[model samples]
Target: MRILIHDYPGYAFPVELARALAHRGHVVCHVHFSATIGPKGTLARMPDDPETLEFLAIGISGTYRKYSLLHRFLQERAYARRLEQAVRAFSPEVVISNAQPDIQARLLATCQDMGIPLVHWLQDLYSTAIGNILKRKCWLLGALAGAWYRHVEKRLISGCAQVVCISDAFASEMKDWGIPDSHVVRIDNWAPLADIPVMDQDNPWSGQYGLAGVDVVLYAGTLGWKHNPALLENLALALKERPKTRLVVASEGLGASWLAERKVEQGLDNLVLLPYQPEESFAAMLASAKVLLAILEPDASAYSAPSKILSYLCAGRPVVVSFPPENHSAQLLSGARAGIVCSSGDDAGFIAAVKDLLDKPENAADLAINGRMYAERHFRIDEIVCAFERVLNHA
Candidate 1:
């Protein structure tokens, strides 16, 4: 069957998923926006890509990620046109829409007119996110905009042949939006396991980064605004007493820059800031970590689940997540016994969790084994793509 996988640009998972489908002997067209104008990611800088699948590149200048009124509407309208034109040209057997709810909502009518089946893959709660963004400036405007978004989101969700959510909580949100449970398929996020194998702490990659003997408290992905930058600084301060322990951040963004400044201000000699590494060293970087960190501000946890956590699991490293226990990330880690979960507000709890792994070195290796086993069962790329293909074919 011919399939179109519409994923936001720069996300590696979608590219891997598209390749898997193409390898299965299906004609696949992967649609993406201009990565150069948006956030930096592995897919954007990929030295090479597969020739098997068709790439529908939509040239978008100026990032649509901004919250400005003019930019949002203009970008949405422009992308809607791009998507319509691309779909008209490709004529795929099925359409799997990923991110950008506003653009996808506009295409729903077009898909109906063309007799094409639409499957919406819910990676995040875009409507709720818009509501949060707007409410930060004006309450009444936020409410009105949120209601409008909900109305359109319902139309998009109900119209789709299938609704694929990245987490159980997101799938539950679809039911709240009046989509039946039968229509929702919950597929947790996954990592490209082939490229990121578990490595030993004593590997040469650790020595390359001067991490041979240092105990690295690593935050290895984009340190975005939604993640409280102050928390990382606080963790650094907490670890100051341990001369051999250091906080290693391999990321570049607003939050990362803030942490770097804090390192200077607070005289945090243990803080090590570096630019994002190439994908080839990603596994070794994680392996070098004594304990990995994944954090989300309390308010943003409901609408988002950082895909980086899945990659951390693949590296077979002990993870320390500062999220609410009720949240999906916390639940997954706690269920697998792969890491420690400390509520975002509990500084003492977070500190103790980190210190425990340091004090009792055996816990680190145990969590690493548990994490790798959990990853093998759930995050294998072949299994994730096979599940996605089944949903598309059945839809």
Candidate 2:
């Protein structure tokens, strides 16, 4: 089968899936938006990559204006046109669309016109997330935009040949949206386990970043509107007394910028802010951490499941996640005994969890072991690829 996997964010595991499918004798063309601002995967083709696997980075003229609503909308439309051209050029038998509802909706129309089966690789509920964020920022405009987005998203979901949901929570949402259970398939998100191996704390990447002798609580992903950056600020303030302990955040975007300003204003020398590290340094960066942190606002908990937590687990590090209890991430951490799971608003509990991990090395080690073990057991690429194959072939 010739498959075109369009993952807008270029996440690690999706690239891994492309490789796996290619290895299984399918010709795969994996595409991502190059101008997106976030931690990306191994977007370039490696020497060991299969001959049938091709990676393409489709990009716009300038940086993606994520916060500028009008500019961002124009950019998204431009990106969709470029994406459509790429799709027409490849003309694969099956298309798996991930992230970016607006872009995916455009692609859906193209696929229908071309008589190609397009699978919706549902990662996040963009409409709900946008609604929550916008409503908080501006009520009337937010409601109007939110409703428009919701309508578009519902059409996209229903129009797709298949929907691959990342969590069971999403399946419930699908049901509420009047999507048939037969149209939805639950395939949990995962990390590239092989790519993110467990590395030593004193590795070259850590040394280069001056993380050699520090007790680091790190958050290394997109800190966007769906997240509460204040939690990170509070965590940094809480760790002020411990000179050796550092709050390292490796990210870019509005939330990161806010944190940067807060770091300076509060004189938080203990807060170390860095842009997203290169793909090669990712594992080592995670290794340098005593505890990994992830956050999701209560509003986002229903729709967005942070894939960073999976990478944190793959790095063999204890994780401290702040999200709602019912979130798949929280449930996964709780069930796997990976680390501590605190509610989004529980700043004190989150602080205590991080401190506990830092203070009790033995307990942290145990949690790290459990997390890695769970990843090893469940994140088998062959199994995941087979599951994807079933859906793609059927579609």
Candidate 3:
């Protein structure tokens, strides 16, 4: 099979998918566009491969142009020519897109022209009805981008030959959008638990970063709009009385200033922010931590998903989720007995839950084992990648 995967959550998903497909004797090609092309934007290099899969990335600079009537027209014209030509030349047997609506629509149309199957990997729900209502009040340019995103999103999903949604809740919303049941399949995010290293005394991060002789609760990922920093601040303040416990947040280029402001205002001495570390260092931090903190914005009830949950589980650390129960994140954590799931805005409950783990380190270890068992049984990267391979082959 000749597979082409569009970039969605950066190189992580694509790299996992590509490696799996290649191992199964399939030729894979991964294509991604530069997320940020200017000084304000940072670029991540897609590593090189000599065989099996070819990786192509393009850097383009244009904010979502919802309000700027002129910019919207320009984007439509530019992508129409550039992307159409690229898809035509790649001529993949199955074109799997990361659901950036317009690009998906173009690939669907182009593949239809060439008699190829088009698959849209639906990672999140972005609708005019919901996302627009929430973020519509952005600055003049941002507002424009918001409106443009709504339009492109609708057209793209509606045209795909198939949709690979990450959860049942997400699939249900796709049905609401008029995507046919036959065209959708549920495939959750996955990680290689086996790939994570075990913690030992000699590890660099074991006793470093103020983690030595402290009760460390780690949150590792992008600290963006999806994460409620206010909750983190509150958690920090609540833990201030626990002199030995520290909340260390490690991420890069995600609302750092916002976190800093809340930390200052709340006077959270236990809250520490660190820049992103390399993959090994990150794994070390996760393994060394006594507990993992997984957070979701209070408003993320529309879709129950978070990519970071599996990563935490794979690290074999007990999780403390700040999300609502009926939501997917909470359900997954509770089902695995991985950790405690706290109600949104339940400061008392959150505090009590953390205290329970701190007071019962043995129970915390058991919870962490449950999480690792779940990851090995269900969320293993090899299992998920193999499932994705079947999707591509059958497409």
Candidate 4:
């Protein structure tokens, strides 16, 4: 099957999927948005396939950095024309669209015109995400935009040959939107595990980062409007007495800024804020953490899953998550008995959980092993890629 995979902000799972598909002898053509933001610079990149033409980067700016909604709307529409032409030229049998909220209708229409089966890969409920991001200022505007987005989302899902949702909550939401269960496949997102092998605590990267002999509770990822950084503040306060335990934040953006400020103002000696590591250092950085951290605003969990959780598991570190129990992240941790899950904002509970692991290194190691095995069983890259292959072929 000639499969076309589209993921804007071209990184992570989709790229891995494309390469894996090509390796498996599928004629995979990946179309990605070309924009580099955040530290992991290759947000857009072509898979290394010299023998076969397999990857194409569609030049488009997907990030809305303090831009007016009108400009963002115009730019994406312009980009859609180029993307549409590219898809027409490729003439793929199936198109799997991942987290593509921009110019969605146009993409769907283009595929429909060519009689190509379209698979809507639902990563987040963009309608809800936009509304949540907007409700900070005006409720009425948020609601109106949400209603419009929901309508479009419903149409796209209904028009698709199949919908692949990354979470049960998202699948359930699509079911509410009248998409039949049979048409929706529940395939969870996975970390790029093959590249992230478990390293020793005293690995060179850990020593280089000065995390050699300390208890590092690490939070690494993009923490946007959906996450609450105040919890990190609370955590620092809770762990103030434990001089050996440090909260290492390897991230950028407002959340990282807030944590840095807290370290200065509150004199959180245990809090260390750093920028996102180079890709070469990423796996070892993750391995350096004694306890990896993941958080989601309880409500945001319905629409967003922190793509970093599975990565943390593959690093063989016990995770400490602050998410609603109902969220899949918490369920995964609990099911594997791999980490501690406290309700978001429960600083005392989170502290206790972290402290429990800190005090008993053996227990933490056991939890870490469980997490590693859980990821090995459920989040293998080959298994996930195969699942997607079956869906794309069948669709």
Candidate 5:
């Protein structure tokens, strides 16, 4: 089967998914669009042309402002044009996108005209209320932008042939937005296991961050605006009494620069901020950590699921997560008995939970074993990739 996979957000998960499908013998043509003009992900340059598959590349430019005249127009023209062209050129049996709703709507029309099936892979939700609140602070025309997003969302979701969500949390969010049960399905996210050599190598982070002798409590991912930066400071302060412990945050995105400032302001002598590491390095660092930290803010909607949990499990490390108990991340950790979940707003509870994990090394070790086993059985990329191939062939 010929498949065209589209993901403009430039995140790692979507790119990995595209490659997985290609590995399964699908003639996959991957299309990536960026809101800013510059070299971003390395995967953007990778091609399937050596195989039976094809590859397409396109770039779109706009300021980060969500509904600015420039951003919306770029989305309407350049991004949508890339989607339309990829579908036309690939002559795909199936078209897959990771939540480019507005662009997806445009492609759906083009696909219907060309008699091609459209499939949407939703990793998260952009609810009218939540998305507006997120970008409204930065958008120049607040009310108009909010209305425009809501309208676009409705049009896109209504037209897709199938919407594949990464979790029940996202699936429920789509249903709440009025997409029928028949139109939406759940397919959890997967990342391939990294090839990290098991050997004694100098810590990639030991010298610069003063992590020489301390055991790390790590958080590895993009440190975006969505994260409460102050929480890191608070964690630092709480761990201050434990001199052997260090909170090491390896992150990318806007919040990264602020990490140094917050560390100074909070007198976080034990907090270390490392630039985002490559995939192999990330796996090594996570595997070395004493504990992993995953957090979600209280206002985060049903899309609060983060891929960090998978990394922690895949790394065979115990995790301490902060999110609502009913949220998918919390549910997964609790069901696996792999981590501790604290209410998103409970600062004291979160701190205490962290200390409990620190105090009980034996319990933490047990959780680590459980986490690795769960990841192997349920979230292994090879297994999930095979499942995706079956779906595409049958769809």
Candidate 6:
């Protein structure tokens, strides 16, 4: 089968899926948006990649203005046109669309026009999330925009051949949107275990970053609007008492900027802010941390699950998550005994969790071992590929 996967963020697991499918003799073309600001996968082709697998990065002419509504809308519309052209050129039997609502709506129309089957890979409930954020900022205009986006989202899902949701909560939301149970499948997200092997804390990358001898608490990913940068600020303040501990944040965008400003205003010498690290150093960067951190605002718990948690598990580290208790990520941590989970607004609990890990190295070691074991057992690419093949064949 000829398969085309448009993963807007160009995440690691999707690239792993594309390679596995190509290795199984399916011709696959993976496309992603190059201008997106986040930690990306190995987008370039490797020397050992199968000949049938190809990668394409579609980019806009200017910087993406994520905070400006008008500029963002125009940029996304322009990007949708390029995406349609890419689909036409590939002419695959099945196309998987994992993107924002605006791009998904346009791609649905393109698929319908081209007489192609489309699989909607539901990563987040974009309309609901957008509406909640906007309503907080401006009640009247936000309500109108949210209603319009919800209509567009419903129509896009209705037209798709299959819907793949990342969590049970998302699947339930789809059912509420009137999608049949048979049309929706829940496939949890994962990390590429081979790409992220467990490394020691004193590895070369850690030494170069001056983290070899210190206790490091790291947050490495996109710090966007949906996240709470204040949690990180609070962590930094708490770590100030421990003179040898450092709070290292490797990220970009709005949240990163906010943290930077706070670091200056508050004179936080222990806080280290850096851009996203290169792919080669990812595993070592994660390993350098004594405790890894992830955060989610309460309002985003229903729609977004932090994919970074999976990566942290693979890196053999104990995680400290500030997320809702019932959210999928928090549940995973609780079930695996891989880390401590705190409620979204529990700043005191979050800090205490970190302090506990730092104080009890033996307990932290046990949690790290459990996390790596869980990743090895569950993140089998061959089994995941078979599941996806079943969905694609039926679609």
The top-ranked prediction according to TM-score is: 6
For candidate 6, write residues 272-369 as lDDT tens digits. 99999988889999989999999999988977888999999999999999999989889998899999999999999999999999999999999999
RMSD vs true structure, all candidates: 2.7, 1.1, 4.7, 2.6, 3.9, 0.9
| Best-to-worst ranking by TM-score | 6, 2, 4, 1, 5, 3
Instruction: List per-prediction Cα lDDT, in the order shown.
Output: 0.80, 0.91, 0.70, 0.80, 0.70, 0.92
* Residue pairs in collision within model 2: none
- Please write out the lDDT profile of model 2 over residues 1-395, one tens digit for every residue: 99999999888899999999999999999999998877788887789888999999998988788888789889989999999999999989999998677798899999999999999998988888777788887988778887888899999999999999989889888999999999999999999999889989888987887889889899999988788899999999999999999999999989999999999999999999999998888999999999999998898886788889999999999999998999998999999999999988999999999998899999999999999999999999999999999999889
**Pairs of colliding residues, candidate 5:** none
lDDT of 3 at 390: 73
Task: Give the worst 10-residue stretch by lDDT in candidate 2.
Answer: 36-45
Question: What TM-score does prediction 5 earn?
Answer: 0.84
* Model 1 per-residue lDDT tens digits across residues 1-395: 88888875556678778877888888888888764232223443233444557766786666555435777678867887888889889888899987667788867777888898899988878777667767878988878887888788878889999999888899878878889887889888777776678887768877987888889999877676467878889989999999999899887767878988899999998999988777667788888888999888776778888778778888988999899787887888989899999998887788889989988889988998898898888877777888888898778
The C-alpha TM-scores of every prediction are: 0.90, 0.98, 0.83, 0.91, 0.84, 0.98
TM-score of 6: 0.98
lDDT of 3 at 28: 77
Model 2: lDDT to the true structure: 0.91
Off by over 4 Å in 1: 36-51, 63-73, 202-205
- Runs of candidate 3 with Cα error greater than 4 angstroms are 34-50, 61-86, 128-154, 206-208, 264-267
Question: For candidate 3, what is the lDDT?
Answer: 0.70
Q: Which of the numbered candidates is closest to the native, going by highest lDDT? A: 6
Clashes within 3 Å, all models in order: 0, 0, 4, 0, 0, 0
- Which residue ranges in model 4 land beyond 4 Å of their true spot? 36-50, 60-75
Q: Candidate 5's error at 352, in angstroms?
A: 1.9
Identify the superior model by lDDT, candidate 3 or candidate 4: 4
Preferred candidate (TM-score higher): 2 or 5: 2
What alpha-carbon RMSD in Å does predicted model 2 have with respect to the real structure? 1.1
Model 2 misplaced stretches (Cα beyond 4 Å): none
List, residue by residue over 1-395, the lDDT tens digit for candidate 4: 78888876565677788877877877877777665344342333444543333667776556644235676677777778888998899888899986446666788999999998889988888888777767776989888888888788788789998999877888889888899888999998887777778998778877886779888899998766788888888888888998788888888877888888888999998888888787678889988889998888876877787778888888999989999888877887899888999998787888788889988999999999998998888867778888988898778
What value of lDDT does candidate 6 attain over all alpha carbons? 0.92
